[model samples]
Target: MKLARATFTPGVLGGPGFFGGMFELPGGYLKPVLVSSCDGVGTKLKIASVMGKHDTVGMDIVNHSVDDILTCGAAPLFFLDYIAMGKLDSALVADIVKGLSTACQEVGCALIGGETAEMPGLYHGKDYDLAGFIVGIVEKDRIVNGLTIKPGDAVLGLPSSGLHTNGYSLARRVLGETPEALSKVYPGFDRSIGEVLLAPHVSYFKTLQPVMSDVKGLAHITGGGFTDNIPRSLPEGVSVRINTGTWDVPPVFELIQSLGQVAPEEMFRVFNMGIGMTVFVDPSHVSTMLAAMPQARVIGEVTAEAGRKVEIV
Candidate 1:
């Protein structure tokens, strides 16, 4: 695990002690555009609080924000974070920053600076909230915004780390948050429920960089799951048909559904079910995309449908 420090980036002018981080765009790119995205760990932090684990949620905030901007084919440059707590717990703050630095190194992003606040009234004891902001660069000609997506374009599925920082409020509602409940190892699960739910969000920046040209559009399946998210990348008069059977849904999702009796559609609407990020490509590039990324699955196709944004069949 590496820390985001000046050692990794001496070119960074003002880092920890300055009012802001200063960066110059690295040489050798043409018409580069900066893409930025921000996100929080959400109620998923509640699980981390209950479990007494602080670091993974830090990774969650960075990875989640990084992936959001990655949809437009951006490479992370620098990241800043906001961690708010009731009291300034030095050990806990250090643990959280440790996770953020490790994730920054993993994505080749600089952890420039951040803010930590201790508000006794706003936040309860030991409870904290985490959010991250990331800025990335991409060539103007290389932005993948799905404008070229057509009816026959093939869809590719990228698997998710369980939960991946979304739908936690509902997840906590269905799955008890008590110490005993979090520790329960369901029949099909090897790790306890808490461990599965707290798995850090996956960052697609490194994995998809090489194959980005093979894709015409990208969608990061986050808060809205398929129904609300897939459409953001789609052109009008066209919708996606997701082949749910194409990949295996993780067991934790099944546990949440079974315990809560959540409807099938609601489950898909809330959690990712399985797929995290989706890649759209010309039908001709299906083989090329899958060959380049073996872990990806051909899970759906675009159709000439107007009313619905996504159809899970």
Candidate 2:
């Protein structure tokens, strides 16, 4: 229903082989500003190929991109995907599309267009890459650029649903990429290692809607984890001071830390360590936001001091 209304003509044009996607949005007096972001699923695809699970990676790309634009206070409108592989299989495409459609519907974003290619010279058997481009809209006045972020503001960390599409290369190097190795279950984890590693990334768009006004900035912790991502959402003179023991670091990270013999600081730099998303919220609204969203907790604060972007204790 959401997609059909925004599409220029449902199923008539747009998607692979078409020149482009046609979308219609009814603009009002609010003067909606468009926000867009593009991202790839990264080396996580290797794990998916080994496990023969193509669905979740599709979700990973969409959710990852959605969260990216959400930092700008935009609500996702539609999404487009690009998939390239060596051999194209109907079953494989179906699984991947299923995941994309599932994620798009969940967030009310239209999965109106996408491309799938078979490149024998470039990719090998089931090995492929996935990328997503998302466009969202927000009122210009409502943009959260972190300019308003300052000292005394509370930093809240949202629990991640496992790795959330990052640190996979190092994880692969540590956890072993073979089918048998992934199938091995370690102590404390009831499921196979592959399942934990393959878990799909979470979407915070809808969940953060209610408290959007109170949030001054948001950092989608990816690629560089807390160290790199948090700074992107901070102003010049302000930095984050995270209370390390505030939230439970998921066991999967501990497993990687132990098995890979990774140093503590490197783990925080390379992975989320538990928090998938961080919010710089107004102190006055902190309690209300926390009460509204039980899964989130006070993880740190904004410091007036400059220099280091993230200070962990």
Candidate 3:
């Protein structure tokens, strides 16, 4: 509690005296709608625990939650975290907080508050769980709900750093669960499996902030991969046709597939394959959007399809 109060200070966050701290928003929004999302690091935490790495997991939760609200064109205001463990280790807790503060500062979000619980029976020795909740604001008129998305709109993809806090359950099974196995370098990857697996989730806020107005829809590729997530942003009667040959599939994904003998179709469904976030925009704005995000690729296009939401070819 002291840490939260000191970190979130007065003026930036609501001062002490209420059950929850207050967040004051500066005027400018015509029809401000508060967007909130909560997400956890999932089984990826198991990898962290095994590796004794807790810092980046904080970023994993924050970035995951941020992207969730970012889909609606919202700017994050504040973030709260929940840490539950069997025992409280000051050093471990501090490391986690350091990561949380770093990510929150990077994205201009306040680490307003958090909860840390020490439950012996609930969690095993030295084990912990991490979750984050974020609140952001977007003008009602400016929300990117995909309702305006039409056929022929271009779908641009933003590349991911690595797994980005998803697919660890299967990754571990494919790569092997032993610590030595995780530390071993794979055929194509320069870094160990642990390093690639623990890469911090990338926040698209900075890249997308300038082009939010031009974007008709946004999808953050996480657990569901392209198949499930892209559909979330599609309107009725429209579907996205992705050209599988448009972008290079990251080597790590290829390594996982070959090692696990995972089928091609399941690879796209379970993993990002390469792209992390997808942006749907007017065909004419493709160059401008690409200029704003040079790393993004013109991966696909939206088409008139009665029932399908996404098609990878």
Query: Listing every candidate in turn, what is its Cα RMSD in Å to the true structure after a full C-alpha superposition?
Result: 2.8, 3.6, 1.8
lDDT of 3 by residue, 192-218 (tens): 888888898898999999989899999
Error of 1 at 65 (Å): 1.1
TM-score of each: 0.95, 0.94, 0.96
lDDT tens per residue, model 1, 89-113: 8788888888898898898888877
Task: Note the clash tally of each candidate.
Answer: 0, 0, 0
lDDT of model 3 at position 52: 86
Q: Which ranking of candidates, highest TM-score first?
A: 3, 1, 2
Model 3 residue 42 lDDT score: 92
Clashing residue pairs in candidate 3 are none
Ten-residue stretch with the least lDDT total in model 2: 1-10
**Better candidate number, 1 or 2, judged by TM-score:** 1
Show pairs that collide, candidate 1: none
lDDT of each residue in 96-167, candidate 2, tens digit only? 878888898888887777777777879876688888899999998999899999899999999998998999
